[model samples]
Target: MSEYHIPVLLQPSVEALVTDPNGTYADFTFGGGGHSRAIIEKLDKGRLFAFDQDQDAAEQAAKINFEGFTFIKSNFRFAKRYLKVYGVTALDGILADLGVSSHQFDEAERGFSIRFDAPLDMRMDREQPVSAADIIANYDATALHKMLGRYGEVTNAKTLAEGIVSARARKPIQTIADLLAVLEKFAPRFREYKYYAQVFQALRIEVNDEMGALRDMLHQAAELLKPGGRLVVLSYHSLEDRLVKNFINKGKFEGEVEKDIYGNDIKPFKALNRQVIEPSEEEIKMNNRARSAKMRVAVKI
Candidate 1:
């Protein structure tokens, strides 16, 4: 067992996705094959198409003994394409555990963790052109400041952006350590680490175009699922959770969970549970990264 990513809410999320007996399933983010393993175990001739952009995750998946599995080597945004290619227009359920895997953070060369001293490259798909270093070095002050504010939730986003612009101009902030050093300059000593994590998060979001990709993926999900199908989402951050919650409950990001002429809530999905399901305390203890996980399940109605 690699033990890098313990797979957050592995039981709850899998149970949500595979509740329908032998239904067609798609694990859009098959990081360690944990959920995939559970889903496959539930299937009897139930075709499951797994998607993982990371080549490492795909290679790791090949080692698993599973039936009714097909690996798609593409971003989950391309899920619609892959499903059509597989001749699966409608799926019984879709599960997405979005964001970077613990494996990516543990591998120092991947540069996803703040504890690492590696190049500032945080691309989920290595083929992507924009990288963390590129975002830090190239984004103008205003643009960088906006990213820092929105994605990182940094209090001193303006100062942080200025710091990066000034430092990169003098000598490019090319590594994770470089970014931290610059962040430490502006961030108070007590809050330095917290602030830096936010700044790095902002850069990574911009580098990966995470928001854009997420919006696209969500749209794909809404369209791909048949009426009354299941949509289960695991989001690590508020930005993602808000979108999922809004879309499922309201059927529109900004619109109120829609209402019918008679005042009944008009929605494509109805909340299966009122409260967000979190990883058990035990799971969080076993995998520290699971602390932030939130799982939500909705049924297409």
Candidate 2:
């Protein structure tokens, strides 16, 4: 597990999640089974359901030998459907660590890291038909601009989009090196790495439909959790954190929360932490990836 992906906010997240040791729980992002292992250890007779779309993660899940653990090889968005198959309608708690795993980034062939010069394939599930390369090759300038600006928040999204269109017309951008050749011209001085990361992240999110999946999963989590059941999410980017925050506080993704006839906010979950929780300086020093993590805990109301 340690070699695969280090679990961020491990102790705090698990402690908050396992309020009832004998209750059913789910780990939506079973990257390396780190969180699932911890949750299983804390359980007495509790059943744990872990989900991950990645084949590599499925392989890791197979290594765990716990009677109470069930590994579901599917996207977390279909969590409710899969859990229902196991007769798990109501959950005690659900923990989702939302982001790409360390193993994915470290593996050069996965095309998740900026350091690698591999094929532009950043699908979480390699079985998926659309990839970063496909998006770059086919998307129009307007579509590309929206993706880069909205998902990546790239400053010069318009210019970059037009540039990509022009560059690809001459030759296709099929690999990491191919994209970088065009991207280098647009990147700011001494900030090439950051620019590359932003572009790659946008492509990854689109390829996986991450935001859409997250919205679906959150809605399912709200319906699946029992009263007072916990929903603990650790989001790495501002876009993910914002969505999690809105859903927990407002029930809906956009606009103000709706009120009932008696004027009570009709939200599903009550946030346990008023402010988003950040990793301690000590933890950040040990794991640099923890620096961007923002943990939010909520309880079904």
Candidate 3:
């Protein structure tokens, strides 16, 4: 799994992020070290810190023995606290490749992909006690329905939640196949794969508390970045993208951009791209995961 992920928008993201070769940088999600490797290559005397919560990712990070690179085996939500331990209070740039990695989905036993028959364990950090199975088995119908509709944007969230509640009462929904069987009727006949993806995404997001973690990281990133430092984020879903956009534009996750008494914007970062960046068709053809990636860059103001 060392040669696993092909970092989405690798060149463009790095080019936009790294303005000073001798400045500090962090890769918030160092999945297979794809983005970390690229960042390290551009650094001459700078230090690079890569964070990954997954134990499996530690093995891949071990392969990188660069002199100025440090790997942190924790979530990026704790970036500020952990980086202070490393004597890094501010950063020149911070890159967050959000959501699940390609390796996570490709690995059958990880239970991230619908293509596999495995336990419903989608914790990016496997050490976490709450797995997808736990959510399916324990979350109330209203909670499940809200998660599906809000995070996954599934059209039939109510029906799917009701179905899952009904089925789990008969037997525990322990595996992917079991959950699929319970929610199969709600899957659209023509877009079954899309429906399954949405349902699985909702469960995964809740189990990992991904949105909560993301918000924490964004707030920290604002404080960590130095003036003119770049904050490049590659989000795989609309929910993630919206959060990044709002935080960069308004300095908060919601509401319009606030201004000081002088009528100047009070945002910490300035949008680098007026429109969101996406992978080219050719790039998407090479890596299907790239199709959903939306990279947004901002400079800390």
**Would you list the clashing residue pairs of candidate 3?**
none
lDDT (tens digit, per residue) of candidate 2 on 28-86: 99998888999998999999999999999999999999888999999999998999899
Q: Using lDDT as the measure, what is the rank order of every candidate, best first?
A: 2, 3, 1
What is each predicted model's overall lDDT from 0 to 1?
Answer: 0.82, 0.95, 0.91
- Candidates ranked by TM-score: 2, 3, 1
How does candidate 3 fare on TM-score? Answer: 0.98
Q: Between prediction 2 and prediction 3, which has the larger TM-score?
A: 2
Show how many residue pairs clash in every candidate, following the order shown: 1, 0, 0
Model 1: per-residue Cα lDDT over 31-119, one tens digit each: 87778888888888787888988888888788776667899988888899889988999888998998578788888988788898999
* True-structure RMSD for candidate 3: 1.1
Per-residue lDDT, model 3, residue 86, is 92
Q: Which stretches of candidate 2 lie over 4 Å from their true place?
A: none
TM-score of each: 0.95, 0.99, 0.98
Candidate 3 lDDT, tens digit per residue, 229-264? 999999999899999999999999998988899999
